[model samples]
Target: MDRMFRVLGFFTLAIGLMAFAGDLTEMALLFFLQTAFFVILGYMKFTERIYILLFWAYMFVTFTGFSYWTIFQMGLPL
Candidate 1:
């Protein structure tokens, strides 16, 4: 499971880099946040601290949602 998260983290990092190269700042930021979450999950030494994952998930979702909302509000078609 740890290996899985590590792989996902690398994948997300690649995605973030691509987004950055494309100048898609919102997506790049979102993917970067996801990468951080996955990396943290991978390094966790105990399952008892699952709340950390929950916090990261909440952050990823909330931040991404708000990013989209702000973009929509600004009428940007990104």
Candidate 2:
């Protein structure tokens, strides 16, 4: 459902914000939350094309962020 996915997205965003002040555990949690949010959007019913596009966009952003975080954690340059 659209409403369900929206709620989940909000929840994940909140968790991601909270994770900003924590350690690896929080970061990992945030990563999973973001992934789930996008995946849910990708599969939700109604307006499938738009939701799919948005899902890919979110995936790109999340993947880039995750890659940057991993690189930073490894003390590597961007």
Candidate 3:
């Protein structure tokens, strides 16, 4: 069971890297930040605090939402 979470964590990291690679400079920094977050979560799997990772996920989502909201208010396409 321990190994399962670790594998899942690595999977998340892989997905992050894949997405990070496709992003251009305009969004590259954000992708790198997100990839780093996933890397942290991957390590956390060994420490048994997966829930903390979920909390970060929530925060990221909230931040992204606020970003888009602000952009929309400014008459941006996305």
Candidate order by decreasing TM-score: 1, 2, 3
Per-residue accuracy of model 1 over 1-78 as CA lDDT, tens digit each: 566677888999999999999999999998999899889978885464564575577679889988998887667764
* Candidate 3 minimal-lDDT segment of 10 residues: 1-10
Stretches of candidate 1 off by over 4 Å are 47-78
Between candidates 1 and 2, which one is better according to TM-score? Answer: 1
Cα displacement (Å) at residue 50, model 2: 0.4
Q: How good is model 1 by TM-score?
A: 0.60
**lDDT agreement with native, every candidate:** 0.83, 0.66, 0.61
> What RMSD, rounded to one decimal, does every model reach?
4.6, 6.6, 5.0
| Candidate closer to the true structure by lDDT (higher is better), 1 or 3 | 1
Tell me how far candidate 1 lies from the true structure as C-alpha RMSD in angstroms: 4.6
Q: What is the lDDT of residue 65 in candidate 3?
A: 86
Summarize candidate 3's per-residue lDDT along 1-78 as a digit string, tens digits.
345445555665566566668765445555555556555655654444655567567679979988997887667663
lDDT of 2: 0.66
lDDT of 2 by residue, 32-63 (tens): 67757655764567675676566578679879
